[model samples]
Every structure is written in C-alpha cells, then in structure tokens.
Target: MWPPRRSGGGDVKHCYARGHRDSGLVSGSSHVRSDMGDIGFKLKVLRRIGIIQPTSPARGLKAAKALRTWGPGFPSGVAATAARFPQQTAIHDDAGDITWGELKADIDRYTQALKDRGVGPGVSVAVLQRNHRYLVMTLVAVMQAGGRLLLLNTMASSSQLTELTKREGAELAVIDSEFLEVAKNIPRESIVLAWADDDAPDDLPTVASISADMPSDPHDKPEKSGQIIIFTSGTTGLPKGARREEPKDLKPLLAYFGAIPYRGNSTVVLAAPLFHSWGLINFGFGLSTAPTYVLRRKFSPEQVLKDIETYRARVLVVVPLMIQRLVDASSEAIEKRDVSSLEITASSGSALAGDLANHFMDLFTDSVYNFYGATETGWVTIASPEDLRAAPGTAGRPPWRTTVKILDENGKELPQGETGVIHVGNDMPFGGYTDGNSKSFADGLMHTGDLGYFDEDGRLFVAGRDDDMIISGGENVFPRELEDALIEHPAISDVVVTGVDDPDWGQALAAYVVVKDGQEIDADGVIAHAREHVARFAVPRKVTFLDELPRNPTGKVMKRELPDPA
Candidate 1:
C-alpha cells in the first residue's frame, strides 16, 4: 500500500457507505461478508453473477484491503479490481488493450495529481470527452479524489457548455483536444486536454502528461465518496444536470444482475454514450464484474461488427438507434463477421420500439434486454428478450427491490390497465438536478413525466410523454401508440408520430416514416396499416416519407428537428 497521507478533514464517514461494513476492508478477511442483508445480498448477487469468483485467496484479500484504503465508490472499484485481476484486460479502446493493473497504475498516479489541484469532497470537476481510456481514468481519478463528476454531453453546444460550466461552478474542465473549439468559452481556469494532438505544446496539461508524473504515494481515503451527475434528455429543451450518489443499499445491484446477464470478466463492446446514465451504469457495474470494455470515441455500425469479431465479445451494449443501424446494415457486412460469441445485446438510453426489438432479435440471438428508465428515475424497468418476444413493446416488470406505480395528476394511485403518469421508487433514486431543480415526487416516489399503464402480466406499456398527449377530432390520442403501430408495418423501418396543427381537428396526428429498403410501399399503404392497427381517431392524418429520422446520440428521436407537416 502507498504511504498514507492525512485527510484534510477528520475521518467523517457517511453511515450509508457499505465499504466500511462489507468490503472486507475493515475486517481484513478473505471472504467478504456483512451483517446487513443488503450488503450480504450484494455479495450473493455478485458471486451468483460470476463477479466475485474464488480466483485466489491472496488476491481477494488484497482487493478487500484496497477497497478499505480507497473508501467507498468508484475509487474502490478500480483499486479492488486491480488487486484481484492485475493481468486481466480491463479496457480496449483505439489506443489498444490495457490491463487492469495498467489502468489502476494510471488511475493511481492521476488520483494524487487530481487531489493536488484541490479536488476532494464537495469539489466539482467537469469532463467533456467521448468514450475512451482517458475518459475512464479521469472518472476514477476524480472519484478517488472525492470530487463530484459532472459529465457533459458531447453534443452540447458551445453556449450550452459555457453556461453549464459556469452555472455548475466547475473549477476545472477536462476536454479532448478535438473539442477545443466547443469548450473554448467554458468558464474554467484549469483546462486539461484529455485527447491531445501530436503537435500540441509540451507545457500544456494532458491526461498522459500528468499520468506520467504520478506521485508514488496514493491520496488519502476520502472522508466521503464522490457523486455522479448525468444530464436529462434535452430533446425538447436544454438538458438539466441530474446528480446522484452511489446507492446506500446494495440491493440495486441485485436488481441489475437479475435483469441483465452481464457476467463478470466477459468482453463487451459498449457503443452507448458514456456521458449518459445507461452507459454509466455498465461502467460502474464493471468495477466489480471487471468486464473487458471495447470502446470507440465515436460509434460506427460497420466498425462495431469488426470490433465484436476481433475481440470475441460476449456482450454488445448499445442504444436502440445503433441496433437499428446494425440491422439496416447490408447482409454482406453482417454475414462477414463472427458475432456468434455474443450472449447479451442490451439496449438503453431511449425506448426500443417493440417492432425494432423484434426485427433485431430475428437477425441476432434472442438475447436482447431493453432497459427503460430516465436519468431522474434510476432503472425503472427492464424488458428481457422473452419479455420483448412475448409482449413485444411492453417494458418488463420492475426488477428485484424496485417499485413502480401509475399515478394520476392528483397523486392518486391508478389501478392496473389504467393509463397514468409513471412514478418510480428504487434504491438509486435521483438526487435532483444540479441547479436545485427536481422532479415531482409523490409519497417519496419520483415522477417519470411519462404516461404508461400496466398490462395483465404486470408489464408496463408506455403510451408516450405525458405532455405529448393530444386531442384530435375531440378525441384524446397518443402519438406513441400510432407510431408503435406504424413501426410494425414490414415496409416501414422507422416512424415517428407527432401532434400537428390541423384545420379539420384542433390537433391531428402526423407521421414521418422511413420506408424499408427494397420495399415498394407507399403513403397509402402506411395509412392503411395504421388504420388496421389503431383506433380511427388515433390514425395519423398526414403521412410524410423521409429517408431517415433525426436522432440524438442515445438513439432518441430529435422531434424538434422534424419538419412541420405539409
């Protein structure tokens, strides 16, 4: 262990930190056990999921000690994983492969460098980089130094970044050199380049430069763990920064393991944006599972096929749009790769349309798991491949230890099969937005701002955004229902239904569709399909054909960019 430095503040521990109780750090025992049922369940789930394997008694013991030394949260995950699996491949990026030991070495060096820059408990550090090894190191470093991590979206505008950096009060901003122009106006003094250019000045700070000068001694264990902040989906407006700390209860881990079969140490190609909560969840989960992550700065459907074959990846993590693009890729492109090693293909970040899910499953294995939740609500539900196959578009039931309720505007609980706003209760609840804004909560459950209902099998079927509910021809209608129906048509590969102004009806539905390749279907066919699938009033009045739909990074439709109905 590195020589201990004094914590600036006295050792003030949060009662919620499970590291003290069950990390096996405090006890120095080979077998990590806890009296608390939650922590015990955590270990059980980890072991059950092949995360806490009996590799070597000595290594396991070392891992426990490392966790104790690093305190709770992301820091401990890095340290403990390194101790247990030093030679194991941890990260695979464009920079090539890095072992767990190598990653820990880099993170260990930067943790001190980060602390020297006045980053610790309650301190804030903003990161603006894509998915890469540098991004991973910076994440662990900030957390090790006990600083709250503000994850900025790569798609944010310069003005947005400037306003956000200033409003969030970020003292330091770490950015990729490629994004230098975008981050130029961000109010920050300590700007560290994440990915620098070859011709960059030697004096300028970069992750590689500071990591090279890493101090031999590790920073002192933080008195408290750091927090993670992700932004809300800004499809409609400016995204708000939603913050959260690691859940005090380990039960949430069980819920994750129960829903998604991400085995420990498996190779996975994660194409989802790391700045989002969906990607962040797997990133955090990998701390214990220690999966080999194959990352690319930018996603490419063609490159993903090659990456999977090259790495023999067992799991493929993606957003729905990526999946759609993959499915749309030429038959020759997909036929060339040996992606048979894939056991799980998980989808998150946005809704995975039922028909799209079915088409994806038809091509690949029936191993799709579409996660449904928002930044404000932590993992509200998970739909397994079976759930998707049987129920099609139904969001699977809440996993272990999570509760979901349908509530009316007055906060009254609605019965099953009744449409209402979605409210969620989970161990990892949202800590509200960084600007002191928060989601509506009812009796301690947070509102999801979505309208959905429970089916006979207790599955959730989201109608659409609660605010998107429209009245057409004096009849209440939901665009999602119509879009869902239209997407099922074989000729149509993609569709989006929205409320458009109409002289005939105060509001009418308008659909923008992308016809499947080699198909000769026309607007009349689409209208006929919708008419057959949905109610008369819910049918889209206007059908506009498009080559493709505008989408955000996470596969969410950018409805704001849609053209007004002709």
Candidate 2:
C-alpha cells in the first residue's frame, strides 16, 4: 500500500490524486507505484548527472548517519559535520579557506562570547551584514547560543530596519561596519557586534574582539531549536516576518535533494544573498554535504565567472537577475574564463523567463535549472533543461510528494489550459507570519497568489500575479507573456511590462525597456516586434526606455517603483 511508505507516512497518491479529481481522472494504488518508480528513476538520473556518486555500502552508511545526526538545524549539523569531517574544507571566502575543524572552533568561540552577554533562548538577535565568512559563522553561533535569528535584508532603508526590528522585538543587532548607521537607533550597550573585523564606529564593538579570548571547547547546545525570522521581499507592502519552526519531517526536502544536483566534496559559489531563503537553504545543505562554499561580500557578474574558474566550482547558486547579469557581461570577458568545471547552475528567487533560460543554457550548456516557489510555500516546482526545451516557459511538474492545483476565483479547480490562482500542498507549509496574519488556505493547500495554468502534459506555467493581470477590452492579459516575448528581441537587454490606467481599454499594457548598449530601438519598433510574437491585446500600447529596471535584492522587479505612463 502506498509504495511501502518511503520517507514520510503521507500518502503520495492522495496528494497528487487531489489535482486529478478536478479533471475526473482515476487514480489508485497503481499511481503510487508509478510515483515510486519515478523516484527510483530519478535516483539513477542523479548519478548520470554527476549529482551523486555511484552507491556503495560504506557511502550509504555514512550518508544515513549524516542525515540522522543533522536533524534539520544548522547548529547541531555543523557540530556533527566537524566531528565527522574535521579536515574537510568548509568555507572559502575572500580572506582564505577554513576547514570544518577551524570553523567549529570559531563557532564555539562566538557561542561562548554571545552566552556571556545573556544571548540565549527567547532572545531575538538581528543580523544586518553582507555575505562573508563572519556572517555565516555568526548565524551558527547565535543559534548554538539558543538565540532566535532575525535576518535583516541589506537593501532595506534605515527606517524600514528600525520599524522591522522593533516589530520583531530584536534586542541585539549584529551589523557590518559599513551599515553601522542603519543601527543608530538601537542602544549602543545592547550588544551591537560588528560582523566584519573592520574598525567599528565610536559606539560599537567588533564581534571578533569580543570572542578573541573565549574558549573554543565544549559549547553548550540549545535546549530547543532556535527560530529563524525571515522577512518578505516587501515589494507590495511592509515586510512581515515569516517565522520558521524546526523541521519535524525532512521528507519534503528529499524532493529537492533528488531534483537538484548537489554533491559532496564539491565547491559551491553562493552568489545569492545569504539573507534570502534560496541562499540560506543551500548554505544549510552545504553544512552536511561538506562542500567548500565560496562567499563574497558583494555580487558582481565578472567576479562570479572568475570565482567559478578560480575555485573550479561545481555548482553556482544564483537568482535570475544574476543570471541576466552573467549573460549581459561582455562576451570577451566571459569567454576568457575556463568555466567547464561547473556542472549545475541552480536559479531561483524569481521567475526565470524563457529567453533568459535559453541564452544561459546556450552559453553554459544544458545545466540551467529554474526553481519556482515562494518564501511561504517553499519549493513548488523545478524546471529541468528538458522541460525548458519542451515548453519554453513552463515551471515544470511538481517534485516528489508535492501537489499543485489551479483554482478559479470561486475556489473551484480549473481544468487544464485554464488560468487560475495557484495553490500548492506539501508536508511542510509555513508555520505562519509573526504578525498573527496567515495567507489564504483551503483544503490544506496554501494559496500562492500567483495565476497560472497546467498543460495537458501536467507541466505548470506561471502567468503573472493575480493582481498584476490586466483586463484589457475584456480579454485577460498577463505581463509575463508579454515580457517573455519582448526579451527575445535582439536589441532589447531587459524589460518589464506593467498595466497602466487607460480609460479606453480599462487597463493598457505599458512596457519599460532597457536597450542593449550601442543599440537603438523606438517604441513603434518594439511594438511591431511584439505583435509578431504575442497576441494583439498582449502587445504594449506604450513603451518607455530606461537605463535599468528597479529590482529588489532577490531580483524581483519593484513594479511599484516603476514610473507610470503620462
């Protein structure tokens, strides 16, 4: 029954069968076996893709032990990895490399220092820093000391930070030296530790100095797992903290481990900000896999390519904006590096447009994977290279043990090929927002606020956000389709399509385009090009040229910031 209950007791058949019920498709025990067979086939595909080594009894035993010891928390996992792979290279940053043994010692020292300052259970600690070895170590130390972590977005304004920190009841703020002004409103004596070793402002102290003489032996483990408060991207409104509880079942993550090509003893270049979910999750996976994570304080496309060659990195973790930047970099600059060592380029954080996907794959081979999910929903789908080749812009099918459905405004499931709101069901839904508000939930599925449809083959394709859809002349239009078509133009470098007020059409399509250097294209030419690829109603009625589109740190377009048409 139910394929012998592989990792979790939740019936896989029941999960996926719910989607088929809308279409009146029959599902039974045979479907469960087919799902299990797919997983087994994926395991073999992973080996062929170089994501996992060929199985051996010793290797299996070691992996099983690692999984059992990690327990879904970074503090305990780091400690376990140090004891097992003491000499393995754990981190490689601008400063130098550090082994698991060295990292553990550093974490222990920081834990001791934080404990002396009364940082323990129920204590909220805010961290505002760039990506570096110090920031990574501080996260582990704070949790190890039994303190909750409030990950601050570096791009937030000082007023925004002050408001969020107050809302989250943060008592201590560990900040980078460059961002000292952002924490000015906080009390100086409340343990404002500098994340980097740079000279602190007159009122602050560096974390390095505080832990310099601390003993690195026998750190105390937290009585319970510490909560991690990650904020929403805040594009639509004020950011809210999405509190994460300690994972009880790791079964949901097994889908990602199967679909993504992360291997042990490999080099992973983390270009995405560590403050975001995509980066933080990969960082946690690195702890147990013992991969050498290459950290950078800032992201630069040129630097990313060079790091791949310099470190001979196997995986490059990034967002869609970073991918666009990599492709935008001069061909001469990109061609000089020997980046053949990279096997998998994992992209998430925002929608990966079809043209951008094809361009990246053409340059780097068929190694690009687009992951679709939200901060609250975790991962919903993964588009493999084959999926992209087939559907051009599909978000791909659901991973193992996950269910997805498209429902209309009436909350009724829509048939295939019909656009509706996307709802996803998984074993691990978010615990809830810290502000006592929850997203729309129905039948145990979390509403994603995105509108999309499923093709006959069951592959999902995301339209735009539900609110972003424009009702022009009674024909529903999504900006994503128009944007994807516009990006294929050779002269256009980047583009964002928005719905602007139009009395004649209810809401007309307006496009903001960034033309490539040394290329000139007028609004009429762009409109003419778009009409050839997209429907007439989907074509933009007006086009505005700009140097670049405004985006959040996670690479999502700040649509609210875009200028309205005159």
**lDDT tens readout by residue for model 1, 218-334:** 566778778888877788788888987675644667678867877778898988988888888888875677778999998888899898899889889899889988988999988
Q: How accurate is candidate 2 locally (lDDT)?
A: 0.76
Question: Candidate 2, which ten residues in sequence have the lowest lDDT sum?
Answer: 1-10
> Pairs clashing in candidate 2?
none
Q: In model 1, which runs have C-alpha deviations exceeding 4 angstroms?
A: 1-44, 69-72, 187-189, 197-203, 515-525, 545-547
Model 1: lDDT of residue 535 = 72
Deviation in Å, model 2, residue 341 alpha carbon:
1.7
lDDT of 1 at 529: 82
Global CA lDDT of candidate 1, please? 0.77
What's the distance in Å from true for residue 505, model 1?
2.3
